[model samples]
Target: MKKRLSLALLPVLMPLLHACTTVGPDYHVPAHAAVHAPQANGPLLGTKHPAVSLAPVPDAWWRLYDDPKLDKLVRESLTANTDLRVAAANLRRAIAMYHEVEADNLPQASVSAATARTQISGESFLMKEKIPVFSIGDVGFSVSYLVDFFGKLERADEAALASAEASQAALDMARVGVVAETVRAYVQGCAATHEYEVAERQLALQERGVDIARKMVAAGRGQPVDALRAQAQAETLRASLPHFKAEQEKAAYRLAVMLGKPPAALPAAEAECHEEPRLRQAIPVGDGAALLKRRPDVRQAERELASATAKIGVATADLYPSVSIGASAGLTGLLSDLGTGQTAHWALGPMLTWNLPTNGVRPRIHRMEAGADAALANFDGVVHKALQETQSALSAYTKELERNLALRAARDNASEAARQNRLLYQAGRAPYLSSLDADRTLAGSDAAVAASDSEVAIDQINLFLALGGGWQNSPDVTK
Candidate 1:
């Protein structure tokens, strides 16, 4: 009898013993991905310039400008930005979903209790005895554990964990974006104010020229047309003032919004800024290897690929049979006999369920394989894009710095020419029109220089953004 009982239990024990046989392919990083190339281990192609250093980028790159106001605004935006709050909530949700999937690895249990009145018919028993109404009571407890003989639950856990990590990376990306944009708005506001001041100075010079031209005409030393020409130039310069003023106001409004405040709430000191922030030292930009590690978009894509790979395993596990072991104990009888030995019952067994091959399991496996292929492609694309953006930003900044140098020189030459022409006119050796023309050229040159200054500041900010340094020191939103 013992031998017979042992044989009887073999069927149930066999599946548990085979629980180590996990189905589907395990995940490995694709060898052909761009991050593995030898070039990625060295300095970036665009870093061979005097304006940038080969040192590792700092976490808070904005501090290189040494602008206390910019640093304060970045910190405030990180804490209060609405987009960051949404990203934080998404991360929390993904973590909760992972926990929900992870719980499936443990046994499931349930308890039930019920009481009801019931009647038995005499005809059903084929006897002349009448059955009286009675009260029935039942209490049950059951536990079931899915024997992961094919690793379905294990794959599910992996996929969920990867998804949670991807969400975390996404939050990091958001922080990077918020920090970059906050810095951008601040720089733009200051740059616009500088341009406005430059334009105002030009307008004042032109107005003074108009007064001198009128005085010369009254003293019979200059033509009425010269005064008219000077007046027209002055009006033209005055007209440009509003546009610069509008740009300053627009930038201030953007900065205010980025800080999570009303547009009108912008500080007077912030709007009064006339000097754009500039870096005193070369910007530190690490290499491609570091960029791959630092950029949150790259991390997010890699995590997504991991999640998709695990999902393929989950789908592949569906091709095999699923096994679950369940045990239950209960008491069910008339209320008067409840809890007695005669009413007690218990059962234990292993259950097997298979979705047969004809039930569309192969197609699901194919779908998952296709999804993994797509994820691999996306990972490659993201890596390439990171490299491209960083290199492009570096090129733009270097070229703009060169352009700014030329503009400053041109402004200086125009200033000298305007001074010489004014001296000649005062000595009665040059026409009023000649001096007037020189002054206009000088005004144009100064405006060009001002605009170039703004562009250079913007380009520097773009390069920092592409380097992806700001998110490293960001506050953890998950806590």
Candidate 2:
């Protein structure tokens, strides 16, 4: 009986033996992976300075400032920011979906039991008038396995895994955004504070000009119009104080939100940061090749393309036949004969299913192909956009550096001229009008220098953002 049973199972196992053939084209990496490669020489169009450095950007690029306060704020934002939390949840969901798809490769089994009572009428037979009642009971176990003759299940798993990776890349991108914005808000607040200080200094200088103008009038060496003109200038400078304070408050509020706190929760030290932090050295900007590798948006696009390629295989596999094997064994009998072996039964077989061409197979294949093409196009677009943004940021940063240098020189010249005018007026050589004009010129130059200083810091942060830093703090998110 054992030998007969083994022979009977041979046909059921035959389909599984030949199930290794995969039907569709396998995915391959594209030949031109990046749209634009870093040129041998720098592509920066501004001043001919060495293009920063060819070194790879550090993960925590902001730490180059050496500000412990900035480092602490960035760390806090990573842990508490609501947007980053949402991205983490999305990554977990994608990983779960991949596991769900993987479970299809295993065999399925189930058990069943039932009991019923029925009545049969004897009147259905000739010359009979009575009815009889009987009880039936049965229990069984069954198993089923799908033979993956065309690799449909494997391709599905491949697609799911790629999607999970794409989700991880998206989380990295969110980290980059939050870190850059937090730094930007902090820098702006400091810049505003510096501007306000510059304004106050200018007001004191104008008040001294007013005093000189009055002294000239009392000594009968000048007209009253000169003193009135000096008074008007001092009033004008005073009017601008409220505008500068509002700018500083706006930046403070934005920084508070970036740290995931109420506007009133800003730290006292940060609110009083009246001096701007300056970078001591040139920024490090790696080549375009490194940029393509480090940017999260580019990675996400490439993974999406891989997922779409795998889905084509899954859809095309449907054009072929599916094979399955199933087996069942059980016992059934009247209550009186429950212990008898004569009630035993078993069966095993293989099943084949196929769709005729009249069914809509061709249209489904077309749909999958179209989706794959769209994904490929999207990947190319992302690469181009990344290169464009990087180049634009480099040019802008370099130009801002050049402009700041020029402003510094002008400020030095204006300060010297103001000193000379004050000395000459005290010696009775220059008129009070000449000293007042020199002081006004010096005040304007000071404000311009402060504004330019702030812009340099802002442009530097923008360049780092284009290079994609800040994801280093949460290294596991990329994995």
Candidate 3:
């Protein structure tokens, strides 16, 4: 009899199973996203220079400088930076949420046991009768499986998976940021130290000039005003030393914090470095196609769009009825007869749930559609922003390279002019004031060169950051 009953239900269930259809618009990569990639996937506009190569960008770009201290600092920051830690935590949470939604596709089972005292009363026979209470025991096991006749759970799983991917991308983005910032801090500290050294040398030269002016005045061969002018120049140069020192200290403090140390726990060796690290070869900047694929922000935006699109299906699924197959067998009786066959019972069937008041469902679907639209727009914006940043960084780096070359040439010319003026002064063929002017020009030129060098180093780091390297091998925090 039970077999016949089960056979009778199969025909009714088969049709519902075969009719399952996912109810929302399917997701595809938006057409506008690929449109933003440069034509022919050619080299970026700013990459047509000797300083930039079309080779693939390095995953660990900071190592290009071959500075052991910088390498160690970047490694430490990647592991210990607080921002990365937070992002890792978020990724873990997202993964867990995805798993939770994924579980809906499997059978849900539950076991329950209970004991209660019950009383029976009889009063409808026209005679009142007292009833005794007795203990009852019940034990049951049940399982239910959602039919997913409308692909509701499937869409939920899709949305959750996309969200998890977005979280992973966000973590990657954070890794890139931490690495770039660590390199920037180290480079800036070293550059400031170099500037400080240059200024100290220039101040020493100026002090000697002041001494020479004083000596000439004492010998009644130079005016007192000449000594005063020389003294004033030396004081001005002395004023700049503190600014460079402050810059070095600030960079050190920033670096220490990034390494998960206190601000006062400065990296002493890094602070003492007087030369900023430089790359020995052209920067490897792959074409636009690779950049679009490599950038984490772009990936994040794309995943968010996918998630939003899935949510539309989720909302649409709400408009239909939910169906599930349920089965249970249990024994229920007085304590004295709980295990008897007479107390056995069983039930097997399908359950249908329909939220009849669906006036709000369509509105929710519209809202989800709007959200997807916004996500699509955001994705396009992120792609364009990534390209813009890369192009701008490349342009700035190349222009700074040109400017640096000009400044270096000016520095060399000023150095030669100062040397000639000093020789002429010693031979009594040039006035002391003329020599002083040449020395001042040389000092100014040296400072300008130092400042320009720092700018170039900073620009290189920025370009690498825009290239979105250094996160390819980021640690798996979700584990």
Candidate 4:
């Protein structure tokens, strides 16, 4: 019995100690590029963006929007989005798969039953034999387990665990994206509202100009063509008012949908959207190493990679002999009715299955290796993409800041010029046309400044997405 025990278990136990030696390189996450990583680049005293401002994004970062309406929308979207439901289902599936893999490493027992009724016709074969009716039923439970003389099952379970983690991260990533898009749509809605107001202001000024030109033409001081030109300008400005208002309304509806509501169903604004999204003026992006850790895509990529690495072990295990043992008991009847205890059978011995004689195992090893390679490349791709996202976000935010400064300067100059022109008109030194031109230019500058403010806000939100925004507080959909 001792010898038998040793024979059955020795092969499995030895290989387990060296489970790490399957074939190709064992997986470990590769290092990040040294360009921005201070760990790789060595410490710098007083770096570009201070660590304090570079805090990891907090969960529920949307509260920074300072708009209760936005908070409600994000919460509503999270609960109602169909895509989130799908992600939840996928997570459950991964959990089930993990359970299945874990089960393989434990003892498996199965109970089965079979009943047979047979009738035979024979003439010359058995003339002396009595044509007796017979019936049989068999039932038994068999248990078997192949101890992990190898880490095959363990590795498979590890891979499955990683897969589950990856699924979770993917879900989180989706949540982040959905929330960002909803915020983006809200910002757009708010910008549209501001644009409509600007159009209204312009239209009012154009109407005043038309009245001026009409009076001048009636007094015979201006030609009929001047009245026509002023009327055309007023009509043109009026046309834009309708268009801008329509656009703003559509933006509001889109925001409602993103909040998971019928556009019309959402509460109407007694007041227009007043969202002020506060973000760090100077964006402080962390180094690549830390950045990689924050990215969900990076986490998901690593999980897939671990799974591919484990498949090699699974395929390699198939190359060796698979052994089994079994025992069973049953009953059969002839003259009398015999049910459960009428018959019995049992056996216990090494049942060896050797498939190494075939060349199938080598091909599978190659396939898994190729898969592992692909996964590594994929992981590498995500890393670079995340780096680029962070860099691009910060770079864009910087440009938007500069643009805002330029816009402000232009606005200041335009306001001063319009004031001087109005003074000159009052003093009878400037023609009415000069005053009208100055007013028009000043209005244009004011509108431009409004648009630039919205742009800066929009770009800052984008920076939030790229930097990985977190939820500040869960949105209260009930509100």
Across 1-479, the per-residue lDDT of candidate 3 in tens digits comes to 66576667678668778888998988888765653555625679967799999999999998899988889899888888888889999999999999999999999999989999877665644558766788999989899999888888988998999999999999999999999999999899999999999999999999998998899889887789889988999999999999999999899998988888898776487546789898989999999889988999999999999999999999998888788888999999887898899989888877767775456988999999999999999998887788889999999999999999999999999999999997887676888889889999999999999999999999999999999999997766555
For model 4, residues 159-275, the per-residue Cα lDDT tens digits are: 798889888777766677778878777777677777667767777876776787678678766667766766776676677667667766776777677666778876766225744
Mark the regions of model 1 whose C-alpha exceeds 4 Å error after superposition. 1-9, 12-16, 118-133, 270-272
User: For residues 1-479, could you state the per-residue lDDT of candidate 2 as single tens digits?
Assistant: 64576567568556656666776668875765554434522443332465377667889998888888888888877877778878989999999999988888877888988777867668667537666688877878898888788899989998999899999889999999989988888888889989889999999888888888789889887779989988988998888788889989998898888888898988767656787777766788877677777889988998998899898888888887777777888878765665479877777766667887568877887888798888888888888887778788888888877888888898889899989998898677997678778888888888898998888888888889988877875735323
Angstrom error of the Cα, residue 439, model 3: value is 2.0
Q: Between 2 and 4, whose TM-score is larger? A: 2
- Kindly report which residue stretches of model 3 are placed more than 4 angstroms away from their true locations once superposed: 1-14, 34-40, 117-130, 357-359
**Which predicted model would earn the best TM-score?**
1
For candidate 1, the per-residue lDDT at 424 reads: 91
Model 2 segments more than 4 A misplaced: 1-19, 33-51, 110-141, 218-222, 328-347, 424-433, 473-479
lDDT (Cα, tens digit) per residue for candidate 1, span 1-479:
54565457678667667666667778888888877878766788867789998999999999999988888889998888888889999999999999999999999999999999988888899978988899999999999999888789999999999999999999999989898999888888888888888989999999999998989899999999999999999999989888887888888888888878899987868646777899989989989999999999999999988989998889888887777878899999999999999999987776677888788888988888898899889998998899899999999999998999999999999999999998898788999999999999999999999999999999999999899888876877666
Best by lDDT: 3
Which residue pairs show backbone clashes in model 3? Answer: none
The collision pairs in model 2 are none
Count steric clashes of candidate 3.
Answer: 0
Give the candidate order by descending lDDT.
Answer: 3, 1, 2, 4
